[model samples]
Target: MDLYVADRSFNKLGTVNNRTSLRWVRRYRKTGEFEIHCPATSQNIEKLQRGNVIIKPGDPEAGYISYRNLQEDNDGKELLVVKGQFLTGYLNRRIIWGTEIINGLVEVAMRTLVTKNAISPTNAERIITGLSLGTLMNYTETADYQTSYANLTDELENLSNLSEIGFRVRYDGSTKSMQFETYKGLDRTAGQSVNPRCIFSKDYNNVEKQEFTESDSSFRNVCLVGGIGEGADRKLTTVGSATGLDRFEVFSDQKSLSNVVDSVTLTDAQYQALLQGKGSEVLTQNKKICVFDSSIDKNANRKYKEDYDLGDIVTNINNKWGVRLDTRIEEIEEVYEDGNEKINVVFGDEAPTLIDKIKQLRKG
Candidate 1:
């Protein structure tokens, strides 16, 4: 469905948002030539003004109007909501509600409902049943708690607004890593809990290497509330030193990430993985628009430009496939003709999709 201005994370409208779904009316005509104005695009019917029906032109046989709690039927076409499944406007780290993946989804859904502008408030209690086995081991673990874990005790005292918190952990055999999920309670006096997991346990522990190795990749995400991202400019996320919202936005947008050639270091495989959209949105977006700028990685340029002529080959290939995309960026060459040579390069949006561009350029 088409996204209207009223729908989205920014102005979260009606049942989809935390606030009561705003009431919208439409005109309808009855079989006996009767007309009325009631709600639009909804399953549940509400009584208004003693059920006064105001009919108008272009009325359908049965059109549900949006009123209180409404569901956006993306499957077949839920007559009410006319857009995608209420996705957030700006990207934010996901907060984990419990150690189990499913619980996390619940906390998020509940939190979304509880926020400022949502209309329909469904009972988040069902998330209790969907709890993962990991949640049993660590009932305390939740997404919010995990984010504040390093020295969570410090936060407990100051959080008069917090009601509770949850925690849990996960253990990785290969990396010998133990992961945790934490959740923070709502309302004042919000206590926190933690969850931990032992994925390296004896039962069914032996498996293949991984998707993120020297030739693969991996990532970590956190969801925070209780004013976590409220005031900060950046989303308080980390991806190598440059923390705050910038990193969050950068990783989320493939375009911004491309400009950051000096931030986190990258390997051929890892970079390629991002290009292939195998890693987190940050890494994927980063790879989608970025390439090895010769000036920064001189040593890499040395090997590729001299020993294997890798740089030259890439240049030749890109030139062949591209329609005057940026001229090949050569580093070792002297600076006689304009230190920063203007290579005619085509970026995303203005050119082709990332996948198509990479596919076209990789032929050589």
Candidate 2:
């Protein structure tokens, strides 16, 4: 695999070898990352910048992971450890502006939101640049909202969740523009016909490591959604659920209700959307089904681009272990060293975030 460095002007600076390792991670509905380790002298250190582009050729799955953070070890010889975040890191530099979007299509809403990101929220004097949105997918629902100071990633995800769709932010290594899309949206092509069961095997030669865990640590069924502020005006919408009530009671407090127009000024539809999104988020958390990490070369020759990827549903049945799992690909981590590649694939129910864990703990 070859790594290239380019300046902000998209001009090729140079390339370097003497590499140690290259690692890239892909996450569902969240930002992913990549890292490159190389031993370089002090003279070549100037080429690595915050916003500069780092391209890794030969892999379609980890198309373009950009540099986010950098570390260095220079005792006798300079060893540069370049850490990077996925394309979604672009949202870190963009913030949502307050705009009342009523009865707006999700595509339009996304486009509208991107337009607001034209100016940098932090640097009022300078404009935010280098954003090129792809074809926004059409969804069924008409999104409505009264926005506030929200991060661009959160804004996109919330809108996506409300619309009952998945969102992914990607950087086009070829186009040199930021890209956004709904999971399984038109931007993505249909997956291949390769059988998932045959794609991942547990044979001694194919499998290196495998593990599974089931936890109720982040389970939530009943969601008592409370809108902004206090008092009777601060209405509470409850998503009644009876599952797992006898084993343990799970509850969630949705502090941000989009439909409540009293204090947050969100319309009823908006509130319902938030309520629905939160409800789905909670209901899916009842059980952490199956977490599988397998290293296999079964489908290494098959097309992995649009075929097997994060968010694709796959069925796995291991009769010996009495494990039958039909789960989505949550995270795909790849490690390359010494001219050999080992891809670690994680399949499970929706992975919870730190906030999700805290919310579950608070209920207890």
Candidate 3:
């Protein structure tokens, strides 16, 4: 894959050549990232600088250059390494300034969050030029969201995962603008007959290598949400119905969500429903994780981008292990090295990393 460099203004600088290796990663519910290693030539060094943009042909998202590292081997051969996240990462730089409540469609709520904080914000100084919301997909799924002074990316990812919808910020080179939109992947699992099914298995010679993980070490099925008030007066709600040995209970503090929203007081029933919704959202973040990691064979029956892409629900079967999973493609990593390319796909919810744990703690 060829890589091109662009300025912050979206002006094409030039193409990058003689690159040693590249790792381009894309995700369904979160911003993607990329890393590049190239010889420390004058042109390469000049092109791969911090604050510049990296573009890949046919890729929906463009990367933002934020880091650079220069290294020299024993033979005195210098190498320049650069890394950054996709255009969607721009949201990470901003936060929800104040309390924002949504009690309707999930798509509208996401758009509102971006608009109120990034695009055309109430504070004109905070507005991000050239950034706009794309046409809504008009999904009917509804949700109740209330956040104050929270990370925009985290909130969006939470909503996306809860609704099984994907969000992206794509750069339009011709228009020189960025568009944010929500999307849902096609159901290509065996249970769905409307679309052609995509299955990866050793029997089919499509999976070059595979690793499956099923763990409940960090799982919590039941969440007892404690809302405003103290002791017995505290509004309480529970999510999940698992009982006996299968039940794992956890507490979620939701004191910030009040009965009043935008100066309008909700009835007791409405407030109770809101608390329940928040409990459900909390449970989603602390549920069991079953992940399937696999390397796909290029010459396999199903193609990469053409057949199945990120966010699509696909099937993975291992008769020997008695495993059959139909899960969404959560992430795809493209590695290009030594003039060859390899693709790695992750299905289902991935285990949280150190950074993820930090974010969760911060939210708490």
Candidate 4:
């Protein structure tokens, strides 16, 4: 492998081509690209030895203590000599989101949680984000009027200053409804810090305009929404459905008979994107789920996204009949480890901030 030039010096340049090979240099003779032929066979690229260390700016001047240590010469070694393809295995074998340990624990818990006498919903919520936890949701809404709007505006501003909170919108989209929500932080602990229980995502759309959406539409009105949160309360629950929607259900298809979601389907690209983006990836969508968030494209075939709203973050997205337009957002937290101690802090969901966006939407 040839040495790339960031400057005349051979330092600062990272190694490429061979994943296992390491590189080091003592001095730069001039200010130009340096060809690094193999030390053994001048034609072959030179490789650094495993465990070799390099000295940087400050140190005992020599040896591999820290890169910061300055040296009359440079030093470093390859730690791992992984041979063969860089990729280890297929999706089926992947652990995902550092959740190898997490999955095992979750599986055991779920078996116990799903007991015959358990209080699980008949119609379950499927997370559009396909989130297990640590997901931020952005939602939109309108206030009653007047003083309420002003109050909400102030609250939103105040909430923004709080270290725990996060945001994306400054009053755009949803001529009638407004957008607001929370962000899921970089990791799970950050998610738990929100001290949250429910996402409380609600939207209003025209009653008509229905077509294919979700992985399968025959399921019709039935769609995968969100699962229950940790701190869900029984009292003061806003969902006052005189009709029967007490239990959450899952299904393979929209068929009235098809209930109980057995498995979820996602593309390799989508899956990798999520894994790489740290679960903060775009919402998984089919025609059945309508989304609003950055513009949306089913297959890059329909790439024309209008000044989209929160609905754009959705997939197979439809709105409740009586409501007008609105955009949404999510609540997220901060996560970082402290000297062997883990820390998590929640933010957003400030009732105060909700009042401000309500006021903004009410404005012309």
Candidate 5:
């Protein structure tokens, strides 16, 4: 496949055909990345612009320019390499809320980021008109983010994960517009085609390898939530019983997770919703799966597919390995080199908690 190089201003730099390697990774609730490598020939070296951007102009979906990398091979031959994240990378350049509630924060942050001079200037406009209220709905308790500082990308991603909602960053070449969406998991009943019982084995010949892993390092049965009000009105509520102490001991303390809003009032329902969501999130992040598929080359995989994506729920039924799992595709890693391509997919569970935070605090 042919490739084109460009600058940040959308100016055409040059073209390269001797592609030695390429990788495009898509992740769930995380930033995905892409990488391209080509021979360092003088002709190609000229294409290695300082502010590199790779584009597959002729191919609509793959034509988006979104990487910057350049290097020399071991043999002293120069190479034009492009590597980085998609539009989501722009979110990493800025920090998000540290003292605001999360209910309407997403809309506000996105509105600011899409401005022409706000973050990264793009030719596309925001096409998303709304977000899934179920995914972003903060019912019970409001948060007063204290001391924590996080990038816009991460803060947004964490919000999605905490709410058990689906989040996506998509580019539409047809309209030349970018879209940010938050919704519930894929609806298999959309009347199209969703086979939750899909099998991947020698009979299918689509899967090359698969691995399953389960761990309890993050099984927190109990959750402690502290409310924001001042010294006299503040309160701490503990959820979950000590019933599973014999089986395993998993304790979660979130007393300082949020500070109360003196002016705004929160209802009992919202508090329960936040507490339930946090507990479920922790319970689901302790399992994982890895799947490998090498049938398609990297260039051919640039386009999107309907059957699977960053957050689609799929089932892997392997009788040989006694594996039957209904999980979500949390991350995807694609590697293309020397005309061969391999796709590594990670499935199951959300992300783990920050254990280091507790350790450091205790040491202090």
Candidate 6:
């Protein structure tokens, strides 16, 4: 896969033909990233400079050059290493600004947030040129979101996880602009007959290697939300209906969700609804996690991108282990080295990182 370089203004530069290795990672619900290692030639050093952009073949996202390094091997061969995030990472540069209460279709709400803060804010200086919303698909999923002083990307990711939706910021070469859009992958599982099913298993010789993980160490099924009051007057709501041994309870303190906004008081029922929403969000964050990691064979029965792609729901069966999973493709990592390419796929919720654990703790 040849890599092309572009300037900050989206002007095309020459290609990097001497790259030794490239690791490109793409995600369904978050910003993607890439790393490149190449000989430190005059052209390589110039094109890989910070603030430039890297474009992979057939990829809509562009990688922003943020870090660069130079080193010499034992043989005195100079090497240049470049690393950065995809265009979606630009959301990290701004916050939600203030409290935002959303109640509507998930896609519409997401676009509203972007327009308010990034595209056409009340403060004209805050607008990001060449950024606009793409045609809406009008997905049927709806959500209730109330966030304050939060990172734009973090909030969008939270909503995406809860709704099983994905988002991206693709650069349009024709318009020389960026388009933000939401998407849902096709259902290619055995249960669905509309589209051809994609099942990976040893029997089919599609899976080269696989690992399965199931854990409930941080799981919670029930949440008791407390909102906008103290002691006996506290507005309270409970989520989840698991009974007996299945019941796992936790508390979510959302006292900051006030019933009165801009002098208008919400009805008692409205206040209770917000509490319910908060409880539901808490339960979602603290659910059981099941992950399936696999290395796919390129010549296998199901072809990548054609039969299935990121965010597509598919099936995985391991008869010997008696495991069957119908899950979404959450991430795909493409590794190119020595003129060969390999694909690593992660299905279902990925293992949480140190920062993820910290965020969960803070929420709890």
Q: 165-278 in candidate 6: lDDT tens per residue?
A: 899888887776889989999999988899999998989999999999999887889889888888998888888878887888999888878888668898888777767767
> How many collisions between residues are there in candidate 4?
81
User: 164-252, model 5: which lDDT tens digit per residue?
Assistant: 45455444444444455554445332233644333334445556666666555545555554444556665545555556453333334
Candidate lDDT (C-alpha), each: 0.23, 0.58, 0.89, 0.21, 0.50, 0.86
TM-score of each: 0.16, 0.74, 0.97, 0.16, 0.67, 0.97
What candidate 6 gets wrong by more than 4 Å, as runs, is 361-364
Error of 2 at 194 (Å): 10
Winner on lDDT (1 vs 3): 3
Q: How many residue pairs clash in each candidate at the backbone level?
A: 84, 4, 0, 81, 8, 0
Residue pairs in collision within model 2: 258-270, 258-271, 259-270, 259-271
**Which candidate leads the pack in lDDT?**
3
Error of 1 at 119 (Å): 24
CA shift of 10, model 3, Å: 1.1
lDDT of 4 at 227: 19
Q: Which stretches of candidate 2 lie over 4 Å from their true place?
A: 58-77, 99-111, 118-127, 139-147, 158-166, 173-175, 185-199, 203-206, 228-234, 243-289, 298-303, 350-364
In model 2, the Cα lDDT at residue 290 comes to 55
In order of TM-score, best first, we have 3, 6, 2, 5, 4, 1
Q: Indicate the TM-score of model 1.
A: 0.16
Alpha carbon lDDT at 46, candidate 3: 89
lDDT of 1 by residue, 50-102 (tens): 11222112211111222222344556533322211101111111222222111
Q: Could you give me the TM-score of model 6 versus the true structure?
A: 0.97
